[model samples]
Target chain A: GQQVMQIPQYQHVQEGEDFTTYCNSSTTLSNIQWYKQRPGGHPVFLIQLVKSGEVKKQKRLTFQFGEAKKNSSLHITATQTTDVGTYFCAEGGSWGKLQFGAGTQVVVTP
Target chain B: GAGVSQTPSNKVTEKGKYVELRCDPISGHTALYWYRQSLGQGPEFLIYFQGTGAADDSGLPNDRFFAVRPEGSVSTLKIQRTERGDSAVYLCASRIQGASTGELFFGEGSRLTVL
Candidate 1:
């Protein structure tokens, strides 16, 4: 059984501040996917990291995969109200099953 | 539909009632997944359908829960003799076959509340 753990169950940041959420796994991961779920909304795909030590960026957000492929991180810079939501890291399982982390709930104050 | 579609966005029933939640995945997508999300928690895997047959249903909590994808298009999740713990947001997602590394397109989800 694979388990994904996320740190900072809740994050509160002021506008223009920077923050980071981490995801760790009990077992080595093949690929990690990031998703954002807004208030009252379903989870939406943000990005996916496959290669070890890979890093990808989406505007103000940065995603990184550890060299060991056991952990991942999402860093948001100059956070805005739009960044308020829960960020989840998921590990893909066989047959399209996903084991999702508990998530990092972010609340940005404007 | 352009994205996954779930019926009865919200449902409220008694603890002993039987409920069925339906999910219509994106057209032509060959993989479907069902997840349960409790308040303040991430989505928990429940079952997966590769086409007309279920490929993995190990995540199902008990025998009271069952799902079917008859035509490889739509799916139905049935919960018999539901309990208060059954209340949660049931999410449906779909992905194209052979794209196991691809992202999942999720529907709005069905919120179930048992009294």
Candidate 2:
């Protein structure tokens, strides 16, 4: 069985501060996908990292895949009010089914 | 369709009753999936359908929960003997081929409340 755990269950930060969330899994993953769920909305896929020790960037957001593919991280260079949401990491395994992480709720204030 | 669509955005039922949630995946997408999201938690996988057959259903919580995709496009998740713990948001998503790419377009989800 594969399970993913995310850190900092909740966080509150200033609009200009930086924030990051970590996701660790008990089993090796084929790929790790990140998602963001806004208030009252479904989770939206943000990025996917496949290769080990891979790092990808999307504007101000940075995503990293660990060397062992057992962990991943999402970092925002400078958080904004629009970044207020729960960040989720979904680990897709060999079965083609995805097991989602508990999610890290981020709240950015002005 | 432009995107995934789910009917009955919300459902309320009494204990022991049965409920059905419907999901219409994106057109030309061969893979459909059902997931449940409890309050303040991430979405949990319920089942994955590749074409008309269920490729993976290990995520289903119990035998009481069943799903069917007879048409290979729209799916229905049926829950029997609903209980309070069954209350959650039922989400539906679809991929191009149940594999890589397309980002898995999702619907707004059907929020179920069992009393």
RMSD of every candidate to native, in Å, equals 1.1, 1.4
Cα-based lDDT for every prediction: 0.94, 0.89
Query: lDDT per residue, candidate 1, A1-110, as tens digits?
Result: 33999999999999999999999986799899999999999999999899999999999999999999999999999999999899999997677578999999999898
True contacts kept of 1: 0.81
Docking level of model 2: medium
Predicted candidate 2 versus true structure: per-residue lDDT over A3-100, tens digit per residue:
99999899898998998899998777789989999999999999989999999999989999999998999999788899999999998764456788
lDDT of 2: 0.89
lDDT for residue A104 in candidate 1, whole number 0-100: 97
The DockQ scores of all candidates, in the order shown, are 0.83, 0.67
> What is the per-residue lDDT of model 1 for residues B1-115, given as tens digits with 9 covering 90 to 100?
5889999899999999999999999999999999999998899999999889998998899999999999999999999999999999999999998873679999999999999
CAPRI-wise, candidate 1 is high
Give candidate 1's iRMS in Å, 1 decimal.
0.9
